[model samples]
Target chain A: MNVLYFAWVRERIGVPSESVETQAATVNDLVEELRAREDRYAAAFADTSALRVAVDQELTDFDAPLAGVKEVAFFPPMTGG
Target chain B: MRIIVQEAPFDFGQQAQAFASGRQNMGAIVTFTGVVRDDASGALTAMEIEHYPGMTEAALTAIANDACARWSLGDVLILHRYGRLTPGEMIMMVATAARHRRDAFEAAEFLMDYLKSRAPFWKREVTAEGASWVAAKDEDEAALDRW
Candidate 1:
């Protein structure tokens, strides 16, 4: 799956997107895998409450199933108008 | 319905005129433009807007379609700009056309409300001190509950 980040999350993670090989079944499980990878990932995922998730470009919760998902994006709450 | 997500500046007046013209059945047209506001400190330099390339258009289209489904709208136009924008520049605009003013006005408002929180765009305000991401306001989220 391809994992993406935006805004401050991207800044903290030091990359916009990455291809990840994971056995996670849900968004939360994927976050855990990434968070355990490095300190930067841990710092970015340190406080999930300040973050939002989208699976396959659709807004969804962290607990959303990642079955057959191709992309996952994490970012701050949108501030557009 | 038209949805445009671009990095270049758009001519609001031209777009507004074009959207309102040649519409005999639509009696009313309401357009709203959002500007990049400078901070009170006056040290702000630019507003950098970041958005997901594929999801931005999809999200805006879905929101506009929802407005059309809920209201008696003739047409809907949404234009949002990304990249570095200086203060006083236009950030985005939404125009709604309907047979009645009520529908046009309400639908335009609905588009604005949803575009604010639901869209995938994020804004970072650049100032002399530093650049920081704009935090989403609680009121913006609460505003959606009224609809």
Candidate 2:
């Protein structure tokens, strides 16, 4: 699956996107998997409240099922106008 | 419906004129422009807007579609720019046309409120103090409740 980070999350993770080979079943599971990878991931995933998630480009909750999901994006709350 | 997500600067006057013209069926057209503003410290150098390439277009289209469904709109136009922009530069614009002024105005406000929180765009304020992400306000999320 392709995992993307945006804005400060991208800065903290030091990359915009990456291919993650995971056996996670849910978004939270995926976050935990990433958090266990390194310090940067841990720091970025430290607080899920400050972040928003999208699965296959649709806004969803952290506990959303990841079945058949090809992409996931994590970013701070949108500030668009 | 016209949705444009580009990095180029748009001519507000020309765009507004084009949207209003040829809409004899519609009696009212409402257009709103958002401009970048300097930080309170007065050290804003530039504002950088980052957005999900594919998802941004999809999101805006969905919002415009919903607005059309909720109102008696003749047409809708959304133009948002990404990349670095200076203070006072136009960041984005939304226009709606309807047979009545109330519908046009309400639909335009609906578009603005939804785009403020739901769109996949993030704004970064670059100032002499340093660059920082603009925090999403609780009021922005609450604004959606009116609709």
Candidate 3:
């Protein structure tokens, strides 16, 4: 699966996108897996409440299933207009 | 319906003239434009807009489609720019057309409300003091409840 970040989340993670092979069943589970990978991931994923997630380009909750999901995006709340 | 997401600036007057023209059955057309606002201290340099490449277009299209479904709209146009923009520069615009003034006005407002929170774009205010993300507002979220 491909994982992406935007805005401050991208800045904190130091990368925009990456390919990750994971056995996680949900987005939060993926976050845990990323947190365990390194301290930067740990600090970035430390606060889940401040972040929003999208599964396969659709806005979804952290508990959303990752089955057959091709891409996952994490970012701060959108301030679009 | 037309959705345009680009980095270049757009001509609002020309676009509005073109959109409002050539309408036969549609009696009303409404347009809204968002401009980059400066900070209170006036130290702001620019506003940086960041958006998900593929998802931003899709999200705006979906929102416009929803508005079309709910209203008796003749057409809809949404244009959003991403990149660094100076204060007083136009950031985005939304135009809606319908048979009546109420429908045209309501659809434009609905588009604005959804785009404010639902679109996959984040804004950062750059100033001499530093830069910071424009936090999503509770009131903006609450504004959606009225629809």
The residue pairs in collision within model 3 are: none
Listing candidates in order, what is each one's chain A TM-score? 0.98, 0.99, 0.97
Docking class of 3: high
DockQ of each: 0.93, 0.91, 0.92
RMSD list, candidates in order: 0.7, 0.9, 0.9
Model 2: CA > 4 A from native: B39-41
Model 2, residue B61: C-alpha shift (Å): 0.6
The TM-score-based order of candidates, best leading, equals 1, 2, 3
The candidates, ranked best first by DockQ, are 1, 3, 2
Residues B1-147 of candidate 2: C-alpha lDDT, one tens digit per residue: 999999999999999999999867899999999999875746899999999999999999999999999999999999999999999999999999999999999999999999999999999988887998999999999999989
Docking class of 2: high
- TM-score of structure candidate 3: 0.98
List candidate 1 segments past 4 Å from native.
none
lDDT score, residue B87, model 1? 86
